[model samples]
Target chain A: MGKTIAEKILQSHLLDDGAVVEPGNIVRAWVDVALLNDVNGPIAFRHFANMGGGPVARPDKVVLVCDHFAPAPNAPGARLIGDMRRFAQEKGIEHFFDVGKGGIEHTLAPEQGLIVAGDLVAGGDSHTGTAGAFGAFGTGMSWAGMAAIMMLDETWFKVPESMRFELRGKKAPFVTGKDVILRVLGEIGVDGALYRSMEFGGPGVAELNIDERMAICNMMVEAGAKTGMVEPDAETEAYAKAHAKRAYTLVRADADAQYASRHDIDLAAMRPMVAKPYSPENVVAVDAAKGVHVDQVYMGNCANGTLTDLRQIASVLAGRKVARGTRAIIVPATQQVYVQAMKEGLIEQFIAAGAAVTTPTCGACFGGHNGALDDGEVAVATVNRNFKGRAGHAGAQVYLANSYVAAAAAVAGEIVDPAVL
Target chain B: MIFEGNIHVVGDHCDTDVMIPGRYLSLVEPCEIAKHIFEEVDPGFVKRVQPGDILVAGKNFGSGSGREHAPFGLKGLGLSCIVAASFSRTFYRMAIDLGLPILTCEAAARAAKVGQRARIDTASGEIRIDRQVFRTQPMPPFIQEIIEQGGLTAWVKAEVARRRASA
Candidate 1:
């Protein structure tokens, strides 16, 4: 009869006094942080304007990130960013991260400590679940829902049942949170956790770093999950203390918390997993997909664009040259991460290895711009979601892998385990 | 609300990208975005769909991305309803906000055929397709109220007016 972490967080933020928090019960809740991006911001603002245009309830809590089409990919994209800039200035919204100031919202939000444990965060982007890595209850909402939040500082939710994932054992060499999540997706298929919170815990949770945790939670949406969370621990505390801008409470699931279903994942048993074209759930071990030729190898996105991921790629491409006929593009997730990578020499090393290191934008990952694939091109990327046309032309194929695997593909021009190199 | 129409069928995991490719996301007009819906998977979808047509699909419909354009485009195409085995949580909320009725009935989704005449009663959760009667959980009273008010925007407008009056 105990409550899950998600349940407890939602309970504390309930807007209706004395409202019960349980799965399938709709409850109004206040959010501590709300994110809007270029793609959703324009629409949300239009709705806000149509609702008789008033000052937002919490300008400080509202975050507008121009990431999806940062630097203005086209005329329309520029217009969208222009709208965001003008609105931010007029409304006095505090946390507007423009083109060069930020990268992806999910990465920048956490890096800037906009969110902390036990807070309820909502964003118009599906990857808002990425904040759950910090033990916060983060979920995606509609633009209209966000507009309503902007007006009232609150939204509604049908409390979702929690699916407990007990990760046990330390990960093997070259294995990462990306592989761990890919393996989980392979086990459950896409809709296995639909509308359910994926709560991670157990001994293996300690073995993964905060960046790894972010990578895992970022893709929970691909599995149709409502949100993804990890139990707060010492590792979480260290990262939060260094970056968190606000006070936070490390919320934990009760000892006897009820779970809709339970899955036990052995990290040691995990390998360099890859999701084939058109589906994140269609996964295969690296060995099974070895020697598959790739025309491009991209290393970036909220899922795998962390500093740790950059280091992993640098380790693989340290002195090697990218294979002939293969293009390697590496993107840092945020401005801070880009500067840190530059200070650490990852950028120079990437460029020296025949790869192109670019600024922190989600352009390539979402096929918005930067490095869209040519027709029939094949790519091995460290990004999540390999859906058709995800990275480029519909005829093109994308293979989702960890940074190590992606970097190895850049060197070998094929899908191969990094350990083999 | 009762909606009667012919159904356009799609399979499971029909993501937002396939529904409305990410490239067209910057196009704010719903009708403009609707011109490209399912262009990749079904190139003829835009040309074939009628104003009152319904969209029938398997589980995990609208799986990827949180773009409201997917529902906006569908609504622009004048879809009466979307009946599927299930809908991703984000898409479900967007549909509700846009006043687009969506029902979760595995039997109804599985039994539906392309171009088949189907009828749905949102209040009753009854789906009728070719003499088959499938029952689904009806929309909750609160959500029904939102739909009746023509979506969240109108509801918010009325609420804002009421609050000002009270103040």
Candidate 2:
């Protein structure tokens, strides 16, 4: 009879004329954030202008960030960013982050305190679900959806049913939030949580920090989940209060709340996991991937390039050089992460270890540039997807693993269990 | 809207990337992007999809990146509708916003075959394919309004006009 966190948020934001919405019901609900990046922002902005919709519904809530292909790789990318800047200025949109100020929108929103608990947020990137770690109902919207929200300040939802995940035990050593999510994807397959709210709860969730939880929720998109949520607790409060832009409210699913399915996971028995080439759903134990030679190992992306991930990799690669003939790339998620990692000497340690520490960019992870595989090359990456041609040439192979696994692969020049190190 | 066309069938998880690869994300013109729609799956797909043609697929069609271009391109190519058992949430919204009507009929999705002549009556919620007839739920009134107004953009324009007049 009770509501999930997603239901509560949608219920609160329902339009005045909107009927009460239950799971599977459809209604228009106000969203707190309308976020987009350079890649997709121009299209939505163009659509908005063409609609003759004057001014944004809420300029402050419209966050336009230039991360993907920012610092413009070529004329087209630059033109798009230029168009976005003009739109932001002409429309008086406040949170417009240009090059250097913002990195990935997923990481930037939380860092700037723009997103908080119990909020409904939408971004134009599939990985926008990353913000759900803060207990916000974060999701990615298509260009048309973005345009609608910009013009009307509200969007519609089907009130997705909830799927509850209960982590029962302390996780295994070297296991990560990425590994946990990979395990879930492997067990359930890609469409396991389609159109469902994946709500994380239970004793073992406390073991993960906000960033780690983000790493897990970010990949919920890979499994076709509409959103991933964690009930905001003390840790959530600390993270929110540290950089929160507005008032915060912790939301939880009631004990008697209905769920489509509930999964109880034993974290301690989990093993280091990797998603083999072609699909994030194609997962295997780290042992199964051992000694598989790799040409590159990339440890960055909205999924795993957080400050914690950088620290985890630094601790693994300290005083050791990258393996011969292997390229190691470390990308911080944001300027703040870059600065913090530099201050913590993690960047120095990585550079000293022969790893290339690039600026915060989603480029390499999405196979844009800065780092990409050529034909016949293989890589072990910390990015979420390893779909064909996702990171490089269609003939190139990409394997997805956690930061520790990626770092170990860099050192060993091959995929392997970090526990063996 | 009632439409009759040949069905171009695809299987589950027909991702947006395959529909319109990211390599063409920079192309703002929907028709330009439409030229490459389904370039990977069937290189001649764009050449064959006539105006008002229909696409039918299994579960989880449009399952990749949130480019929004794929649906827009499909619409620009004059695709009348997409009927599938299910659609990725983002893609479903995109299809709706692009004025591309989508009906979810499991019976049609499973029974419809490629190259079959199909007719959809959105108002009647009937899907007729060759000799098979499948029933689907009509779009809710709110969704119908958006479709009638020609996608989200035109709907917003009309709403803005009405609001200004009232004010």
Candidate 3:
């Protein structure tokens, strides 16, 4: 039996006494990157202290980011940020990203070249799987698990079985990675890939860029997956060459790799998809949801806040003003992305079109701040999750869509396909 | 370890947001978080839930977010265990790491009713609900060890000391 890409990465990082890298076997493996954010950083720092705080095994590999509650939304949030700063300084952690320095941890880590192909990355945030976009094995863990990694530079995992998603054909115009993933979620339902690795490959993978790949991998968690990945290709190599700070080996699945199951997705047939309120799996075609009034339209998050997304959104909002009754919030995921959007004039177009463009922060996406919804409000956003109370008051509803569709909604004040706009 | 409690039933996809809304994530104290458990989805849940009550739910329980606060809050409220048809990987790991025992048994989860007394034997993977009996795969030795050691925090503490002493 040949090995899958996930198995190969995990096996390469296994400790001397680690178990075999097979499905259902628990193995302790070294981590290349251990990520933390303000929401979970303080707790993890406390655990690190409890475990006899000393110099971290790999300070450079450990990253602390403050985007969840950047700039401090309240006193408690401020305290969390303060604790992260103190710990970062005390430990001499080299990759501590404070507010105004970085954006969301997921988006920031990759842009800074902290992750590379074949690396095993763990973080305290669910969307940590976004690193899979770089052809690395990325998964989320508990704070205690993160603390253990911080101290010992290793963590345990029960190897997940692999599920292959073969992408074929080119995607339709205006259809982004968000639509592709929503379509997958609709097919698999929540838990369809429970505790399994979702591996993307085939010719269609070439059609989507890094941003689209990131968007696809980021939502693997929504399908209850352990991680999501794309096989390293020319585009991946180009990305790594441009940004990677360290050397990387492109790990690919063997020709006869074993997969628990496989699904074929034809990107050409893809269309604008929407996930109704309270569940990412509650999906429908845009036509089914057309004319559904929306009070707000938000574009940006770890899932869809890349430069690609900004360009897509800007293209839709180029000469259009936000509908009279609707408000739009556009957030660039990272400082670099924000600056790039500004240089490209995407930010200007957004603001000139009545959309509020904000700095790099995860505030509005996680309901931390910036633009939480009011009761009874309805929004169409590019965020990954639409669970109740995800973006604000419990009474508010959110629909998940690609950036193009979301921007179209901002201009129409209703759910409409970007193609028609 | 055997735990007996009345189960509080919830439907599928009981996400972390419903368990503890993102707004209250800033509250690190478990007790403070316990007060808001299921506050958004079921307003009276906190008031009605008693100590040692088990949570029975359908598929994909704790389906969203990697926040440990969800399981931490439940443990703080004295939840003895959680039995679900299935659990999201993140929540499942967080629960075990927090020393909160959970079991996945489709039959048991489906058969369970609100206010019914259920008993779970972690060692045997046996679940008794009312007059019905169900069996699930027992947790692996590593996970059992973590639970016995009272979560990863305590386990890591001892491991750190042991490694230092040996070194």
Candidate 1 deviates by what RMSD? 0.9
- In order, the Cα lDDT scores of the candidates are 0.91, 0.86, 0.90
Winner by DockQ: 1
Instruction: Residues A69-176, candidate 3: write the lDDT tens digits.
Output: 887889999999999999899989989999999998888888899988878999999999999889899999988899899888888998999999999998888887
Interface RMSD of 1: 0.8
| TM-scores for chain A over all candidates | 0.99, 0.98, 0.98
Candidate 2 local lDDT, residue A104:
80
What is candidate 2's TM-score against the reference?
0.96
lDDT per residue, candidate 1, A157-200, as tens digits? 99999999999998899999898889989999899999999999
In the order shown, the candidates' Cα RMSDs to the true structure are 0.9, 1.7, 1.1
User: Which whole-number lDDT from 0 to 100 does residue B3 have in model 2?
Assistant: 88
Q: Write the per-residue lDDT of candidate 1 for residues B1-167, one digit (tens) a residue.
A: 99999989999898998888778878999889888888888988888889888999999999998889999999998888999999999999999998898899999999899979999999999999978999999999999988888889998888888978999
Give candidate 1's whole-model lDDT: 0.91
What stretches of model 2 exceed 4 Å from their correct place? none
Error of model 3, residue B99, in angstroms: 1.0
Which candidate order results from sorting by lDDT in descending order?
1, 3, 2
TM-score of each: 0.99, 0.96, 0.98
Show the lowest summed lDDT stretch of 10 residues, model 1 chain A.
Answer: A358-367
Q: Candidate 3: lDDT over CA atoms?
A: 0.90
The reply for model 1, stretches above 4 Å from the true place, is none
